[model samples]
Target: MKTSLILGTALALIASAGMAEQITVMSWGGTYSQSQVEAYQKPFTTETGITVVSVDSDNPAIPIKAQVEAGNVTVDVVDIEYADAIRLCDEGLLEEIDPAILPRAPDGTPATDDFLPQGLSDCAVGSIVFSTVYAYDRTRFPDSPPRTIADFFDTGKFPGKRGLKKAPKALLEMALMGDGVPADQVYDLLSTAEGVDRAFAKLDTIKKDVVWWETGAQAPQLLADGEVVLSTAYNGRIFNAAVSEGRPFDMVWDGQVYEYNLFAIPKGAPNKDAALEYIAFATGTQRLADQAKWISYGPARKSSAPLVGLYQDGKTEMAPNMPTNPDNMKNALASSYDFWVDHESELTERFNAWLSAS
Candidate 1:
């Protein structure tokens, strides 16, 4: 009888293990994903026993839309830009996320109040505040480094290949700023056809010297490998390359275009329950701050700031390196989600045509 009981318990344990929950999360690859793995995924798995499968994508939004529309949803969670999240949600491709699922701050502040105003949405929860900024090899510009956005486009003076993202989003805005447009007026100007033409005209100045990158990791690599003297990159990638890998890369924040990166669950996700659990855990007060230690992106939750300290190296301070730092924000531009939502298709189409021309 005792032997029969033991066999039955063993069978139950095996079945439970077979049914264990796991969720796949997709995000931009490189150090950014590594930060999430250490600060969010590891702890989440430890606390809940739900396995997390981290996947890398040049852009998560593309595959998310494709998978949902095809009725073969694979990723349960995705880290997407603010504009993409709104666009996807409006298309009914994402699951509606309730803010109540988020945990309150340690001081008893509601999570809704603690997160930055831009962090929460109908279907998304913000994760980090990162910037699309340009960086240069310190060795390349040791004597007279580029200081402003205009310098990035002044190839005749700087005289080297430039690294730029193939997309129009931040590129257009930076081009306009480099042409002397103020950060506040960038979107207003881009809203017009003449403004669009002007931005492209500025880009025309360095068209022959541009080397394009499609992925975040490639931007830093391009600089390290001497493929380009200067590159527009996610600020955190450049930070990781310098501090972690000892690459002599330095960022130029003058025209930095900053945006919130958010987490969302796709509609019809295979493990929606686990996905929700993971997002709530990952965006909590502590987890958001912990992420800053691994990368320079600012935490999206206000309550998380005090918890943030030195980098994973245990020596480098994380604050001044953040894109949100007042020093960095002197000339920084907040990415306008409304503008992108209204103009992305038109601008992207125009950009493609221009890239293919001549």
Candidate 2:
């Protein structure tokens, strides 16, 4: 009788521990994302007693697809690139989010009203907004900074060397914009055969002067060392470099190409309830605002904007990346994920061929 009672007690304890919630979250590997996890996800787990399995995903879809195919899906939530989120949603790999579970907006506005129009969908929620802009070495060009996309490509005018992203999306848009196409007409122009050729022809003019960046992280290093007078780079990379290295670098957000990172729940996840809680906690107004202080990326929640006063005061020029800033948010161009997803394979093949030729 005593042995049976002890055994029963042990089994009961095991069952209780097993009932504890565990959520697996996958996100891209970067200093900014890491800081977000620490600031938001860690506190959430501490408060709720849930276990978070944070995974760094260079390509989140591969592992997620494999798990689903193997009939052993474990990923609960995923933070993916804006374009990748669209692709996954289109393929029915993500679960629709219920906004009712979300925390109230910081400013007492409706939660749905706080988000940008593109941000309010059911499939995913916007977490951070990053910019692809011109980062120039202030020491090299002390008199004036390259103010626009046109200045970036004009080597003779801004003169010295320039760097551009190796990827085609932003480069294509910048080329069209430089060719005098209005911002509103950029996508329409690229959708045409002559417009596409015209954009490439414009790029060809600066091909020799352009040092193509392989990754977002690489741009800061190149700029700090003065490899090129001006380069297109992620805002976070430039901000971090300036703060850490004290390198004389400045970013110009004029004609910036802004992209969002989204948090989505993968379909067939093992812990949907815990994942939802995690999302609600991470995207909560306070946590979102906290994240902005440590990283250059801006929070999606409008209410979080006022909470970021300290960080904003320190980096006034970086306000353009902030979602609450009307002028910045208004002028920012949202890259078309649909177009990229539709033509990714062909576009990638063409991009690779062109890169190899150059």
Candidate 3:
């Protein structure tokens, strides 16, 4: 009887260990992923005993769509841009995440009311507000650094290779801005054929001097390697290089394009419940604020703003470095989700053709 009882207890222990939960999260790699790891993944695992597996992607949306359509979904959660979140959700590739699952602010504000406008969606929850801004190697352009967007295209003045994202989204908007278009009128003008031509014409000026980067980490490396004097990069990545790594880089916020980065679950996630639990925990007010310490991106929740403080280094103030800072917003443009959803494919094709032309 004693041997049988001991055997039963051993079997039960093995069964319980096998049932421990794990969820995979895909995100744009580099410091951004590191930030999420520190702020969301680590604490989450500690608190819930669920293993969080981190994966890197050039863009999470592509894999999410491919996985869901192929009927072999692997990632449980994805960190995606606001535009992709809406587009993927509309295509039924992502699971619907009810906002009620999110926690309210410490002051008792509801999750919906506490998040910034457009922060909460039918299928995703906003995490950070980041920007695509141009930055230059301070050591390279110590005396006569490029200041405005136009300078990014003026090879005669800046006089070195410029690094740009391989995508047409922010580049088109910035091109028009460089060509002297105002931030507010950029999308309206881009909706017209002539405005599209003007933007491309501006890009043509620096086409030969442009080195295209597909991932967030490559942008900072381009500047560091002296491959490009000025590169348009995600602001948080630049901040990580400049502050944490002590790189001599400075950002040009004039004509910056800012947008939200949200968390979503792909359809058929193996651990759907754990993924939802992770999202709810990560998007909470404190978690959002915690992310700000690791990177310069602004928290998506209004309540998270007050809690934002110094960077992880414990000296550099995070607010002034954020893209949403009042100083940075003077000439900033908000990325239009509607515009991208409508024209991404058409413009991407044109941009690729332009890249191939002699």
Candidate 4:
């Protein structure tokens, strides 16, 4: 009888361990997401004994919509763009966060406070802050490099072939800025008809010189191949291309449009509890600081700034682009996800029309 009781207790413990819930997290697959999982998610599973199932989605919304519509919710947490986060929340497709169960800053303040004011929202939280900036091939432009959006438009001053995103978000902002609108007045200008036309008119000045990039990878490639002397690109992709390929390229952060990649729990998630736990772990200050070292993309948590001490090789100048630097953080123009959400379709149509005319 004693032997039987001991065996039963062992089986109970095993069963309980087996029953520990697993969570499914969906994100864009690339070095950034992979490094994040390796550095944070894998360790989280080891410490908590909860399994994490990472999945890839080209368009995060597609899978989410399919699952939710079918009433068979599988994804627990999703890493998406801020615009999509706002759309999903409006559609009632995401679970409201319970911050009480999540991690707090070391000061015991809520972690939400560590993010920029625009970055905080009721149903989603900022995870990564990425920049859309100008990259130039140092070899091609040995004498001059584009420093700002105004320079990007001035073909005669910094004359070189140029590349821009096909998307309207960054281009529209750049257009407004180049048309003599101040950075602070960009959104306001775009909100008016004459201002919108002025932006497109300025873009027309460089239409022939501009090559529109469809993907993040294309931008850096154009720079490396000398197809375009300068291109607007994601800082991470451009940095990687320059470092890995020995390309003579550098990024100009001036007048850059910064957008936040967000993480949110999907509605009716099978493992909502585990999903929140995973978000808290991934967004912790230490983990974010570590991530900045791996990828140049900036951390959303303000506290992660100080944790990024001098780089291993003492590259101080390179440190500003390291994501944790206050100056870079300040220069980044926080993208208005709400505006994008409201005007996506119309903006897309206008962009397509402008591209066709170009």
What lDDT does each candidate get? 0.93, 0.76, 0.92, 0.76
Positional deviation of residue 54's Cα in model 2 after best superposition, in angstroms: 3.2
Which of 1 and 4 is the better model by lDDT?
1
What lDDT score goes with residue 184 in model 2?
A: 79
Clashing pairs in 2: none
Model 1: ten consecutive residues of lowest lDDT: 14-23
lDDT of 3 by residue, 292-346 (tens): 9899999999999989999988899998988878999988999999998888889
Winner by lDDT: 1
Q: Give the poorly placed runs of model 4, Cα more than 4 Å off.
A: 1-21, 310-319, 322-326, 329-332
lDDT of 2 at 169: 78
**For each candidate, what TM-score against the reference?**
0.94, 0.86, 0.94, 0.86
User: Model 4 clash tally?
Assistant: 0
Q: Which residue pairs in model 1 clash with each other?
A: none
In the range 98-130, model 2's lDDT, one tens digit per residue, is 888787885577778886555656678877877
Residues 102-210, candidate 1, lDDT per residue (tens digit)? 9999999998999886899999999999999999999987889999999999987799999999999999999999999999899999999999999999999999999
